[model samples]
Target: MIIFPFGKAPAVILVAALLAGGWLLLHPRGKEDANLVLWSFAKTHITAYNQALPALNHAYPDVKLSVKQIHFEALNRRLLSSFWSDLPSQPDLVEIEISCVGTYFKGPKEQIGFEDLKPRLVESGMYNRIVRNRLATWSNRGGIYGIPNDVHPVMLAYRRDIADSLGICVDSLYTWDRFIEAGRRFTVEGERYMIELNEQNVGSLECFLFQRGGGYFDSLGNVIFDNPVAVATMEWFVPLVTGKGRIGADLGSGQNAAVLFYKALEEGYYLFFICPDWRSSFIQEYSPRLAGKMALMPMPAFYPGGRRTSTQGGTMMAITKACKDKDKAWKTALFLYTNPEGRSRSFKKTNIIPPFRDAWTEPVFHEPNAFWSGQKLGEMYIGLADSIPPQYSNPFVVLAKGKLSQALVSCTQYYSVNGSSGFRDHIRKALTASADEVRKYQKRGLIE
Candidate 1:
C-alpha cells in the first residue's frame, strides 16, 4: 500500500519510471490481439485494473489489459498532442482528471479525440446504473465520453480530541455561521486556530462555488464569473481569509506548502480542514502521529437547508477513438470499473468513494475506520454523495480560476486595509474584466 506523496516527487518519478521501462505490461499483447492499454498516473487506479485481470480472463478469455503510468499534466499534454498526428502512438483507454476533461471535450468533435461511450453504455443496459450527474465532467454536445471512477464529495474533518478538550460540540455546528462562531470560541493565543488557509490554492473557493450551485460555466457552457452567485460566494469567503479568524491566508505551494501543512497538523495549529473524502488517507499517511485524534463531519451549509456537501477531485476512464478493438476495449473498461467485485477492490485499495450507489449496501461500507476512532466514514460518504450539486467546467477554467483567485486576493487585501465597504464592487469589476479576456479565447476557438 504505497500512499502517494503530497509533494513534487511524483512527477519526477513518473517520468523516470516511464523512460526507464518503455511500454511495459503485465502480459504481452499478441499482434492484432484483444489487448487494451490504459494510461493513468495514480497507482491505485492501475492496481484496480490489475486486480480485475484474473476475472476479466475468465469472463472474456480474449480480453487482455495493460496500464501505462504517466504524470498527470504530461499525460494531458501528450493526449492532446496525439490528436495532431495521423499515426500517433495512443493508448486504448485514458484517465481524465476532473479538471482537465474540459480540454478534450471543448475542441471540434470531428477531430478524432475520445470515443463517445453513450451507445455502448445504452447497449449494455448499464447506462442508468451509473450516477448520471457523474458524467458532467466528460460530457459535451450530448456525447458522454467517459465513465466516472470515483465520487469525490467534500466534507469537513476536525480534531475530535481538540474538540472535546475545548468543550465544543462540533456535531451541532450545522451552518457556516455556527461554524464560524465556534471558531471564534475555539481560538486561543499560542494554540490551535480553526483552519489554515492557502492563498496559492482556491480549493475553498471552488468548494463553496459547487455548494452554491455555481461553477466556472453554466449548463449552456457560458462563462459566468460576474454572476451574482459567484460574486456573493467571493464576498462571503473574503473575510475568512483576511480577518482575524484563525485562518492563515498566505500559505505557499510546492515543498513549502507541504511542509507548512504538515507542520500545522503536527503542531496542532487548526481545528477544521475542509477537503474531499480522499484526504482521510492523505492525513493518515502524512501525519501518522495524529491518529485517532481527528474525525469526519458533514460540511456546514451556506444557509439553513442548503447543500451540506460538494465534489472536489474525480477521475474518469475514456476509451480512445483510435483504438483498433473498440468493442473489446469498451467491454474491458466497463467490467474493470462498473462490476461489483471491481468496485470493491477499488474501494479497498484506493479508499475512494465509489459513484455506484449499489456498492454502498455491502458490509465493508458499514465497517468503522480505526484511523478516526471508529467513525463510520463509508456511510457518511454515501449520505453526502446524494446531495452533491452538479458541477460544470470550461476549457478556460484554469484561466478563469486564476482570475477568481486574484479577485479574492485583491478583495481580501482591500478589505484588510479599508474594511468591507465597496469590496463587492471591487470584486465585480475584476471578475468582469477576467471574463472579457476569456471571451476573446472563446471567439477565436481556443475554447468552446
Candidate 2:
C-alpha cells in the first residue's frame, strides 16, 4: 500500500512517486469510450445532476452521461489514486467538496490533473455572469481547476414557535451583540439552549469569523488565521460555547449528529443555528415535522453595516485532464450548471443557489417557500448572494482547518481554566503559533 500520508513533504513526495509510477492500481482504467461518467460525493448532487441529463441530452444528444455517487472520503482517495493513473474507472468529470479540493493541488502544476477552465469561462461569456468570488476556492497557483456549483450564503434560522413567545422576530435581526442578549433571555436551563455551538467543532466560529472578514487564508493565498478579526471572533464566540453560563450546546458530530439534531429539534433544545443556502435541504429532509414552524433570515452582522452573509459549505465541478473527451465533458458541465430549467429543479430539491447570474431570474427562485413559514427563501438567498464573502482555498488550508480548530479549543479551554482575564492576549499568541505551524508546513511542502 502506498500509504496516504499527510504532514511531511518527504512522505508526500513518496506517495506522488508511487502514484505517478502507477503503483496504486494494478489494473488502471483507460477512458470509458461509450459514456461520460460524472462522479459526485453527495447523493443530493448526483440526484441534482441526474435531473439535468434530459437538458444535457437535448442540447448534445450524442453525449451520454452516467451520474454516480461516491462516499466522501472514498471518493477523495480514489480521485487522488486515479488522478495520475490511466484509470478506466476515473470519471470524465467529478464534483469535489471544497474541504477536499485543496488536497488534490498538493503537488506541482503538472501533477494537478484538472484542466484550467479560466479560458473557457471567458470564452463562454460566463466570466462576468457568474459570481466571480465563488471561483477563488477552486483556483490554485494561478490555475482555475473547477467550476463553482453553488453560492452557499450562510444565514440564521430559528424555531419561530419558540421565538414568538419571547416577542423576538427572527427576521428582524440586527447585530451579534443583540443576538447575544437575545440568547441570554431566550435560553432556559437544561430543556433548551440558544443554539448548537460545540467546543470541539469550530464550524460556527468560522461562519462568524467570515462575517467579520477573516478566514484561514487571504485572497492572495496567504495564511491569515491569526489576523485580528479571527482573534476577536474567537474571543466573542468562545465564551458562548464554553464556560458555565454557555448559551450554546454540543449536539455531537457526524452521522449521529443528525439524529441528535432531530431529537433536539423536536424538543426545541436549541433556538437558533447557522443556516446556509444548502443546509435547508438537510433541515427539510431530516426534520420535516418542523415544517411551517421555522423562520429563515440573514445572519446578523458583527456591526451595523457589515456583510449580512458569509459562505459556509461549498462544492465545485472539475473536468479531469485524463478524460479523452474534454469538449463533451465541458459541454455537459456547462449545460447542467447554467440551464435555467435544470437549475430550477435542482434548486427546489436542494435549495443551493447556482453561482450563475443568468439562472437567478427563474420564477421558482422568487416564490414563497411553505417549508420556511411562507418566507421567500430563494429571494432572500439571492438578495444575500452578492454579499456572500469568498472563501480562499489552498493545500495549506487543509492543515489550517485542523490547526485553527485546535486553536479554538485551546482558547476556550484557557478561558475555562483561568477565566477571561488575559484570554485575548492568550488567543493572539496561540493563534499566531497555530498560523505559524501551517506556514512551516507550506514552506516545506513547496520544496516538493
Candidate 3:
C-alpha cells in the first residue's frame, strides 16, 4: 500500500477541527441582542432617541436594541389592526400619548403591567422621583401602565409690550372677569380684538369646563356636558367667536390653528393666545424678531381666588408584554426619565420637560430663554406642575372629548350663521347624540 507517515496526523487534525466547530455552534455567544422598536409622531422625540440610544448601548454592552419611528396616529391604527389580525409583528416598547392609553389598555391583549417592572424602576429611583398623582399613577386595581416622560399644560401666552402699553397689569389679569376686561381693552372696534377663542381650540373647552368644576363625563360614566355648567361655559365662549373675539382667517383655515395663532401674534393681530411649552422653540425658529417680547402666564383662574391651571399635552412610555427583554426595556425607560445627565440632555436638545418631580428642581429648567426676554421658562412650567390635577384616567374621556369637540364646532356654526337661538337646547341634543355614540363604542369595547 502507498501510505504516507503524515496520513494519520492529517486525520487527527481534521477530527479536532470538526469538534471545535460543533462546540462553538452549541455554546452561547456572550452577547444577547434585543430587537427593540419604538413609535413616535413627534419629531423632537426622534431627535432625543438618536442621542439616547448610544448612551443606552454603552451602559449595557452585552445587549443590543433597535428603534423604529412611526407617526403617532398611524402607529395607533397599525397596532390595533395587528392585534386584530393576530400578526406576529409587534413592538417591545411603545410611546403613547396620555389621552390614548385607554384605547390600548382596554383591548383584549393588554401589555405587561408596571407592577411587574416596579422592582427595577424603584431601584433606579424613578418611582420615587415621579409625581404620584400626576400623569404617572399606578392603577388601584392592579398594575401601573405608564411611565410619564414629558408633561405640557396650557397657559396664557401674551404680548408683553401690548399689555404694558394698554396699562393692563398682567398679574391682575388672573380671573375670568379680569381676563374678559383685558381682552375688551386690547380689542379695537374693527381691527384686532382683546383675545381669540374658537370652537376649533379644544383647550378652550377644557379650560371652560375646568373652571366650572364640570367635566365631560361624571364618575358614574354618564355624559354630563348638557348640564348648566357646560351650557354656561359654551355661552360664554359663543360671543367671542361671533363678534367680540372675531375669528381670524387663519383660525378657521388651518390644520394647526396654534401655528396660525402664533403667526398672528407676530403680526400684532393677536394680543393673547393659549399655548404650551413647545411653543417656545417655535417662536425661536419662526419669529426671531418677536423674541424677548412674549411672556407665559398661568391659565386664568376661574374665580378671583381660584386655581389657575388646566392639563394639556404630554406623552408616556410603556413596556409591552410582547417585549422579550422586559428588564432591559424598563432600565432604558427609567434612565430616560430619571438620570440627571440624560434628562438635562433631553431638555437641552428637545425641550421635553421630564415628568420626574425632582428633575423640575434642576437648574436646567431655570435657565433663561433668550427668546422670552431672558425669562426663566422653567419657572413657568414649575407653576403648572404645582397645579396639575389627579390623573384623568378614563378612556371614555377621550371619546367624549372628541364628540364634545364636534358639538362645539356645530354649536359655533349655528351661532355664527343662524344666530344664537335655543343654543343650549341644540347643544343638549348634540351631547345626547355624542353620549349614545360613545355608549355604542363602549359596548363594542373600543373604550371603557
Q: Of the candidates shown, which would achieve the greatest lDDT relative to the real structure? A: 2
CA-RMSD of model 3: 10.5
Tens digit per residue, CA lDDT, model 2, 158-270: 89888897798664568877888878877876878888887877788888888888899987667998988888888888889877668888777877987988779878998
lDDT accuracy of residue 233 in candidate 1: 86
Whichever of 1 and 2 has more lDDT, that candidate is 2
RMSD of each: 7.9, 9.3, 10.5
lDDT of each: 0.78, 0.85, 0.67
TM-score of each: 0.89, 0.89, 0.81
Steric clash pairs (candidate 3): 187-194, 292-373
Report how far off residue 297 is in candidate 3 (Å).
Answer: 0.9
Span of 10 residues, lowest total lDDT, candidate 1: 243-252
State candidate 3's TM-score.
0.81
**True-vs-predicted CA distance for residue 362, candidate 1, Å:** 1.5
**Model 3 C-alpha lDDT per residue in residues 286-365, reported as the tens digit of each score:** 77788778787887787876777666666777776667778777777675567677778767665556667766878999
Candidate 3 deviant stretches above 4 angstroms: 1-35, 107-125, 136-142, 201-203, 210-213, 218-222, 244-250, 253-259, 390-398, 414-426, 444-448
